[model samples]
Target: DTAALMKTPLKKGDTWYLVDSRWFKQWKKYVGFDSWDKYQMGDQNVYPGPVDNSGLLKGGDSQSLKEHLIDELDYILVPTEGWNKLVSWYGLLENQEPIARKVPNAIEKEMRKLFSIPDEKEIRLWNKYMSNTFEPLNKPDSTIQDAGLYQGQVLVIEQKNEDGTWPRGPSTNKLTLTLQ
Candidate 1:
């Protein structure tokens, strides 16, 4: 039913069902309906967006996040300061959607190989459990999915600021790596 209704206008109560506002905005402009705000119904709450951890979703988000993430960058590799410290840069992959059902402690051993980390510093990614040997990935794991990383995305190999922020050495700095 919803699939068949995609091309047609839909309403939830008195408000218009907004599948996507950006698409609608662009759709209107491409069709020369941008100024047709009067034709556009419903409040901002009808916008569509990604679902958060609670299994709940916030609708009608335009600037904060996006949907149909196939053509976007899933994550950014940001270098930390001092030694090697990687904070979280979360963006989901393009073609390969993440397995959202998985628990928070998702594991990805290969993510370690993606980083250009020094040999001595690699252990920093693991917890200090020398004897028991029950250590897990110290790398930023949430950026990784058990299903595998997004295509063409790789790790950052730079030093971040002492406060655990990405280093912006110049007016513009972009570090991209190809996942091996």
Candidate 2:
């Protein structure tokens, strides 16, 4: 079904995940339809089911507080500062798709320009950090090593830690330096 959908030309009823207003506008232009109308149709919800969550669980009247404590824990543990922190760290969260596609490349380009390195020093640094940090956490028997330099100014090093263990301390860890 997915393959068929992809192969067939998009029709009026076909669903799409628009990245932003710009992409929506572009799709509207291509499809010869009013963007507002398309948005209106997309906004409409026609689910044929009870909307409320109340009284949905079995034995709802007799449910004990101790038994359901974990279920309500998420509500109590809500990080009020999380949204602000995420926005501060990652910028506006609404336009995530475009930012996800564009930001790393932009950052890499800027870093390369700032460092004035012909080779991809930034990518190497990223690879090193991932090897040291994530590979240990996720996989076994994976070792990263220095892959050599891209440009004269940059050095490409592979992770050599066999156990995939991350080094500790402030100045000694390659991952820490790369992140900084």
Candidate 3:
């Protein structure tokens, strides 16, 4: 249904569309759950691996256009430096920001149209789920693999330390994506 829906362009100003967020399941449990046993189911917290958007296993193949666009629009790509540029364009970057990430205004407009959020006050979305600090969503604290994001999901920036490096945590190099 998602693939069929995304195949065409949406022209209406504010229409709701399906967004994949199976990737953030563990992160949700990590931040929201009171105990490990509550969210754990076998190796559920562990990163199993990446799969195609249709829930099919895709050995070593690259992400399809649908998957890429879904990730790009959902802010699931936040861990990469590319995400910084998108965030900057969203005008969320603060003064003295470390990175200079920007894209052309025309492209930004088009992107907003495609991934239009239902709520302009997107900060509420993040606060509703996790604390203001990115510490709970930190790679070290969560340890889950990167995954697809749900609709209306806002990207949370992991604050860098005073030493000009990211906070100390286990390096989560795993990549796992799921869509539901």
Question: Top model by TM-score, which number?
Answer: 3
lDDT of 3 at 51: 17
Write one digit per residue (lDDT tens) for candidate 3, span 111-180: 3344663324121111114432222233222211132233344443333345655443332433222325
Clashing residue pairs in candidate 1 are 47-60, 48-60, 74-91, 80-159, 80-160, 81-160, 125-138
Give per-model TM-scores.
0.18, 0.18, 0.21
Which segments of candidate 1 are over 4 A away from where they belong?
A: 1-109, 114-139, 146-149, 160-167, 170-180
Tens digit per residue, CA lDDT, model 1, 149-172: 333433333344556554433212
- Cα RMSD for candidate 3? 22.1
Clashes of each: 7, 7, 0
- Give stretches of model 3 more than 4 Å off: 1-20, 30-63, 67-75, 79-104, 108-180
- Choose 1 or 3, whichever is better by lDDT: 3
What are the lDDT figures for the candidates, one per model?
A: 0.30, 0.29, 0.31
Model 1 residue 36 lDDT?
51
Q: After superposition, how far is residue 142 of candidate 1 from its true place, in Å?
A: 1.9
